[model samples]
Each structure stands twice: as C-alpha cells, then as structure tokens.
Target: MRPDLRAHALHWHDKTRATQMEFGLWQVWEAGWVTAILRGASITILVGLVSMAAGLVIGIVCGLIKWARIFPLSLLVDAYTSLVRGVPELLIIYLLFFSSVEFVTKVVTAFGYAGVAESGYAFVIAVIAIGAISGAYSTEVVRGALGAIPNGHIEAARALGLSGGRIFRRIIAPQMLRIAVPGINNVWQTTIKDTALVSVVGLQELMRISFIGANSTRHPFIFYLIAAVVYLAITLVSQAGFDAIERLLRVRTRK
Candidate 1:
C-alpha cells in the first residue's frame, strides 16, 4: 500500500480493536481492579528498592574483600558470588522458602510464640533472595570499578602522608562510585524484573497481582499488558534518573 493508505489502515485497525474489546477494558477499572493493581505495583517498587539497597551493602562488602584480596575471606566471597550468580533466581527463592521457613518457625516457636505465617515472612525472604542475586552481580561491578582506579593514585596518596581512611574517603570512594554507577544501574534494572519471580512464593508483587487479576477477571491479556506497561514505565523512569546522575557525575569529574 502507499504510505498514507498504510497509515490510514493501521489507524483503522487500532480503532476497531479499541471499539470491539470484548469485555470492555473500562470494566477492569470500575470495580477497584485498577486500584488493586496499582497497590501491587507499589509493593513491587518497594521490594525492588529495598532489595537493591540490601544488595548494594552486600556487594560493597564482598567487592572490597575481593578487591583487597583478603585471603580466605576473598575466596569465600568468590564462592558466594559465583554460586549466587550461577543459580537460577527462582531456585534461590525456593531454597530460601523451604529452608528458612522451618528454621524461622522453630525459632519463633522457641521464643514462646506460634509459628509465624508464611505470608508474614514472605517479604523478608523475597528481599534476601533478590538482594543476594543482585549482590552477586554487583560484586563484580564494584570489584571492576575498584580495579579501574590506578594503583599510582593510591601510592601517591600514601606518599603525601594521607591516612588510609583519608585516601579512601577523598580519592578512592568517589571515583569508584562513578565508575560503578552504570554497572550498578544495570543490576538495579535486573533486580526490578527479578521481583516478578518472587510471585511464585506468593509475595503479592505486581506480577502475582496481575496474574490474580487476569485469572479472576478472565482477561489475561489486558492484565498482563497493563503489567508490561507498568514495568516499562518504571524502567524508563529509572533509566532517566540514572542518566541524570551519570551526567552530573561526569560534570563533577570534569571540574
């Protein structure tokens, strides 16, 4: 077809689809379904943020151990990063669910309480599981960032009689962070997507809620499509924020 005719055909197709949606997409919004999905989305965001924060802490500690080549400790960090990175994230969640649940239950019982419900502890487990996976990747990112800093700079700082803490605080930390931001951002993106996996263990994050909505309403495509759009929105907004941070870092570096 000619260009204008093709455009007209495409527009007509979209209009038809919009008009003929069998269930009327508006129905999904009428009975608080949209509110439920949005609430689930908020949980998804919370899980992602908290998981990433925990991952950053774990990554920094493990990365530093490996970077400093801290003997057997570095070896242990290596094993941790390697194991977590190599495993499927869902398997990790399952492992934590089965393993930690009983142990935590027993502990709670010992403390003069009935065993806590699975749902009660699901969020904590999700955070730890997702954080560990993110941290595994983040360890490599941080280690590489630390490695990128020239040895000469550290030596020079030492030669200037700067204390170890001062050298790290003044020169090393900032540059390492700048170098690591892109890698960390990559991990952050992965972490958010991985939150979807936690749905298997029933954490009620966005994916699980979407699945529930889809099943309950018999509108799988609509709910899943909405989920995709929400995920994309989150990713785009996060990308923009990271981009701004990166540009700001570059400007400071130039100064």
Candidate 2:
C-alpha cells in the first residue's frame, strides 16, 4: 500500500487514541523536523557556496586558457568542457564518489605516506564532483562573456602600452562580469539543484535527510512535502540575494 494511505489509516483509527498519538507525533515533528531541516539546510548551503566558489576559480583559469588562442591548450580545454557538458551529472557524482578514495590513496602512496584514506574524504570528493560540473558551465559563461567585450577596447588598452595582465584586470574583468552576471546566476541555481544528486552517494544533504525521515516515519508524503518546501524556500531566498547583488553592481557601475 502507498505509505500516505497507510498513514491515513492509522490516523483514522479509534478516535481518542489516534488523536493523542497524532498530537504527540505532531509535536515531535515540530521539534525534531525543524532541527533536521535546519541542519540539512546548513549542509546544502555550505556545499553549494563552496562548490560554486571552487568552480568559479577553476572555470576562470580554464576559460582564460580557452580564450588565449594557445591552440593545443584551447583544444584540450574545449574537449574537457564538452565531455563534462555531454555526460550525466549523476554518473560524474558516482564515479567521483567511488574512485576518489583509491585515487587519493594512490597519490599518498606515491609520496611515501602510509595511512589509509580518511572517511571525510567523501565530502571532499563530493565538492570536487559538484564543483567540476559547475566549472564546466562556468567556463562557457566566462568565455562567452569575454568574447562579448568589444575588440576596440582591447586594442586601445594595447595602444596605451598596457601589459596583458593590466589590460585584463583594468579593461576586461569588469565588462566581463557585467555581461556574465545573468549566466553566473543560472550556474548558481544549477549548482544548488545539483547538490541533491549527492544524496545518492550518502551525503546527508536535504534530500538524503528527507529520505531518512520518510523511511523512519513511514510518512513519505509528509516528509517529501517538507523537503520540497525547504528546497523552494532556499531557491527563493537565493534568487532574492542574486537580484540584490545585480542591483548593487548596477548602481556601482552607474556611479
């Protein structure tokens, strides 16, 4: 039978006893579920923020390589971005989760270290996997943004005897950011949603916690609803934050 139906069945039983039990369950849920959701939210936000930051750093480096017209290196970056974009995100997560420890152990052994890989290594692997996915998308976003900058500005900077680094820092970076804000916002949303996939690897983010709660309480509908609500709340708040950031940037640019 469906778990929701079963819950309804139990709730519909002898009035007084059912009422008492339901009230107690409600109280427990109010207290414990709130705590669980808060903890899960913290984990999810941390993972999203950290992964996005890591991805941005990696992506900028790769994007610069791709943009620099160093034929072989650009080709390699293109291949990497294409492979990541073409493959399933879940497959990436699984591969990283299962292979990370062995890879770390091998590297450590090669360096003459003796201890086994630590359990916390899974968290690092999760971050890498998610960050890699985000980086792939970010690379394209940054590359496109860089391309959108007018060629005349770069030539003018060059004419002014500005070095490459100074040209990029002073002339290219701000314009690229202005053009890339919307794309980066989309990447951030994608990263937030993608964090849910880490649940399959036993990371106790929001979805994983919801799965546990549903299984333990046998109230799948309730728990799933709660999870959906929590995710929606996160998305809404993040969207607002991004909007505020965009507005602030626009004001500063105007000034």
Best by TM-score: 1
Q: Write the per-residue lDDT of candidate 2 for residues 1-255, one digit (tens) a residue.
A: 999998887777767676765764695477597688678778888899999999999788888888777778889889989999999999998887776666777776777777233444556766998999999999999999999999999999999999999998988998889888888999999998999888887677888888888787666666777778888888899889888888987987798
TM-score versus the correct structure, for each prediction: 0.88, 0.83
| TM-score, predicted candidate 2 vs. hidden true structure | 0.83
* TM-score of model 1 vs. true structure: 0.88
- lDDT (0-100) at residue 202 of candidate 1? 72
Per-residue lDDT tens digits of candidate 1, residues 39-127? 88999999999999999999999999999999999999999998998889999999999887878888877877755544357788899
Where does model 1 exceed 4 Å of error? 1-24, 103-119
Best by lDDT: 1
When summed lDDT is taken over every stretch of 10 residues in candidate 1, the lowest stretch is: 112-121
